[model samples]
Target: MAHDHGHDHASSTRTRLAIAFAIIAVVLVVEVFGAWLSGSLALLADAGHMASDAIGLLVALVASVWATRPATDRHTFGFRRLEVLAALFNGVLLTVVAVVVAIEAVRRLTEADPHAPDGIPMLVVAGIGLLANVAAYLVLRGGDRRSMNMRGATLEVLGDLFGSIAAVVAGVVLLTTGFAAADAIASLVIAALIVPRAALLLRDVVRVLTESAPRETDVTLIREHLLETPEVVAVHDVHVWAITSGAPVFSAHVECEEAVFAEGRAGSMLERLGECLRGHFDVEHSTFQLEPAGHSEREEPAHR
Candidate 1:
């Protein structure tokens, strides 16, 4: 039953991602043509961002679809982690695009008699691109925003939307004042906007890849909660981490009174401990290895 629910969620996310990708892909084609016709750096930069966003959305869709596969003996967790990898890739790609755009903008700004871009065409294309991005954003807004895959796709669309706005503003300035550097300036602004968000996304992806605990989880508090269990005497080797965006996993070694094993109460104690974790920490998947007091000395535990 739980498995079916998860599958449905992934399917819904994939559908939303597909819709967004199609919109971005169409807008990308139009923007590329407009950039070529107008020779506007702002339009070109926005197009490049849109291209990256289209790729990001495609990756997210593939990852969401992959996540629906059942786990196999050889791959116990199945393909859920693929979504994290896709998010990391998307962040890195966006960062690279931003850097390239910034460098090109600088070069254009320094050039002598930089050609005046066709502001009218830029305005028309940017307006169209903005509308398209807004549509994509609306499509994804209702989906799972907590998932890194969905978040990555959303981030891309948001960046593209901002890029479109910058392009339109630059177009207006270019048309009114004939200031050729306005296009370059807008490109730089778009690049600047992308860098911080990309960096934050990359940081989150790295944290997950490293198996660090989720930011919202506190290991000490969880250990304390386990110790509060009547049958539990001590808790050690507690570890908690996110498998993906919304899926957190927990494992720990819990020492209980020796009577728990002798009286056949270990099973009940384990269930109670699981309940405690679920109720207090919102952890749905947990593994607790119940051990008798002083058992750690016999086998040499990994951590105290």
Candidate 2:
């Protein structure tokens, strides 16, 4: 039943990504034309962001599909980790787009005969792009937010959302007040919105790649929980890490009572420990090696 629900959820997420990808593609076309017609750097930046988003969505779509491939002898964990790689790419790509836009905005601001954005076209096109971005954002927002791939995609749309707003504001300001710097400033605003979020996502991607435990997981608490079992005298080499977003893997070496080892009761004790891990920590996959007391003396100290 759990496996079926997970499959259904992935299917639904993929469908949502498809819908968002379509919206972004259409928005990119409209925004590109709009940017050209109005000479607004803000609109151009938004268009560039949308282009990156289109590619990101494609990567995410492929990752999501690849993640479902059955495990093979060569790759025991299957391709599920590809989703994290997709998210990593998205984060880096978004950061590059923002930096590029910021540099261009600064150059435009310094130009002696900088083109003043045409407010009528900027307003009309930005309005259209804004609506399209809203639709895309809403579509992606419905996906599994816990998944890094989905979070990256959703963040891209959110950047687009804020970019659209900046452009809209720039348009209104330029149209009503003839503020020549509004377009460049709006472009900078769009860049600003993307960098921080991209940095945060990159941090998460790195955490998973490095096999660090999930940020919210407490190794100490996990140790305490294991020690709660009377037969389990001590636990060491406790390691926990997330494969992607919600999928965490755990392993530990447990020091057990001499009787538990000698009396052939380790099997039942192992079940109890596994249940504790799953029930209390939400860890579905775990491996434990039972050892007699003081057995770890022969082993080197673990990284923990």
| The candidate that achieves the highest lDDT relative to the unseen native structure | 2
Residue-wise lDDT of candidate 1 within 192-245, one digit each (tens)?
989988998898898899999998888999998888889788888878888898
lDDT of candidate 2 over 1-304, digit per residue (tens): 9989989999999999999999899889999999999888999999999999999999999999999888999989999999999999999999999999999999999999888999999999999889988998999998998899999999989988989999999999999999889999999999999999899999999999999999989999999989989888889988899989999999999999899978899999989998998999999899999999888887876434
Q: Which ten residues in a row have the lowest lDDT in candidate 1?
A: 295-304
Model 1 off-target regions past 4 Å? Answer: 298-302
Query: What's the TM-score of each model vs. the native?
Result: 0.97, 0.97
In candidate 2, list every pair of residues with a backbone clash: none
Report the Cα RMSD per candidate: 1.2, 1.2
lDDT of each: 0.91, 0.92
